[model samples]
Target: GKFPEISLDDYECVMAQVERQYNIRCYNLYRTYRTTKVRPIHVAPEDWQWLIDNLWSDEQFQKRSKQNSINKSKQEMKSLVGTINIETYEVTLVRNPETGAWPSAVDVWRAIYMKANGTWSIPNGAEILNNLEEAAETHKERIAAAPIPLAEHFALVLGRKPNHSRGVGIGAVNQGAQERYRIRARAEAADQRASDAQNQAAALLEEVERLT
Candidate 1:
């Protein structure tokens, strides 16, 4: 009888399966399982640790993974009050009642502190947070009252439509917007084809049932 110590290749193979099954990085699978003491629904509970230990030394056992497409959509969402600074690592909010969408932390922080009244001092973080929370509630209520349909809402969430907190259907196509929109179109067409296929299958089954 022989027990096999997992090779790096085997560890990678399992991580690939975990990624395919759960749509997550191997690192996340390891961390979540360790911290929560709960089995990830997408991965086998038994081998999680073994995979973690074996794969930890690999350079690609990344600490932070790329934001997946869905999270990218969420990050682009305007309902979120503030953004994480990619460079200087500051969290900032937009206070302009006119524009709810502020994409850059440095620009916003400058507008509020550096140049607004020729003062180089920034306001307290809590003040900004409170202001945005109020604005967020108002925005939520307004969007709720708008005439957007459920189907259109799904499109917005999926990046089929542009990320618009203030305006719906405003997909100001960036450099790759056309490509993404095309992909969305293809996916929609595929979904329709799937529905048609399901219907045909059901009808065929019903006809067979009748014949028998």
Candidate 2:
């Protein structure tokens, strides 16, 4: 099919007809060109070329950046591992002179350290043995003559209770003292009641004599 070419006058007339039908204004075709105050659209060839080059280089930079980040993470992990790798020492179990039994230096040391660390339970054998050996060395004399009751020896020497529950001599003494105190209190109370009764009986006898 052959298409018809319309002249500028015919095109303008058609636009005017459409605008009139639609109740809108059409662009003027006969305006003269002038240097008006307006913002100009500027394009920089250098910047555009730079952006194109950068877009191409971005893949390499991103790959290197990702590798660097992974390397940094690996280095941090290695540092952490180095910090956590602690050396453990060997400890021996020696006979406690006071208790007359084998006392593990590791157990004692571990107990002390655990206590310091706010833990009540016994620590691993290695740590316990290490601490006990240290303690035994510090107090050699006390360890030599192992006392029958380890706890009592500790109390006597240290002026307080020992962590190990052995030979608590004061428990019976404390219980006896409490019983004696209770008995004394009861006796005092009974004496007071008996004295009051006697006083009442004497007053009753005096009243009877006066009436007679």
Candidate 3:
């Protein structure tokens, strides 16, 4: 009679026996059955306790979750490696109290000369001096290397000598020509020195890497 076709209580006991033997909880079985076409069933309290004890171990989950969070934070910081804030100041001149006027040409020129000579004063003064020095140096070099005596050539072309020419045109053509050639030669030498410096710097980097 198959033991009167086993009562529901008897079947549950058999299932519980199998669950214990396999170290699986009965709550898992109930959940699996509930997902099927079967009507919903409540998990037994004992089975629910068994599932909580086995699956919801707090220590293991927290360690893994914390490690993942730390790794993500490190990655975010690495992405911002070169991001930084910088401050800069702009130099500007104001009216001179004593002079009661804007800067004079001579004052501006002096500032420029000082800058080129690597001398510095106040921010405004240093900026102006640097610019002036660069311009004056460039002009002086150009004049010194002109194909002919600059003042004399200007006198010839303009039909009158510059106001303070010092009669350079009548003084020494040969000497002026030599000076022009010397200036060009010096410029070439300076360019070569710059190239050598760049090469040396590159070599130093390679040497450092090799030593390391």
Best by lDDT: 1
Residue-level error in angstroms, candidate 1, position 76: 7.0
**TM-score of model 2 (CA atoms):** 0.21
Tens digit per residue, CA lDDT, model 2, 30-135: 0100123222235255644454467424788557656855643432211111311010111233346798454343343343334454553323434434444565
Estimate the TM-score of every prediction: 0.26, 0.21, 0.21
Candidate 3 lDDT trough over 10 residues, lowest sum: 82-91
RMSDs, each prediction? Answer: 16.5, 40.0, 37.8
Model 2 ranges with Cα > 4 A deviation: 1-159, 162-173
Candidate 1 structure lDDT: 0.44
Cα-based lDDT for every prediction = 0.44, 0.41, 0.43
Tens digits of per-residue lDDT, candidate 1, 141-178, equal: 54344343221222333334444322222323322333
Q: What is the lDDT of residue 98 in candidate 3?
A: 92
Ranking by TM-score: 1, 2, 3
Error of 1 at 189 (Å): 7.9
Off by over 4 Å in 3: 1-146, 149-152, 158-172, 207-212
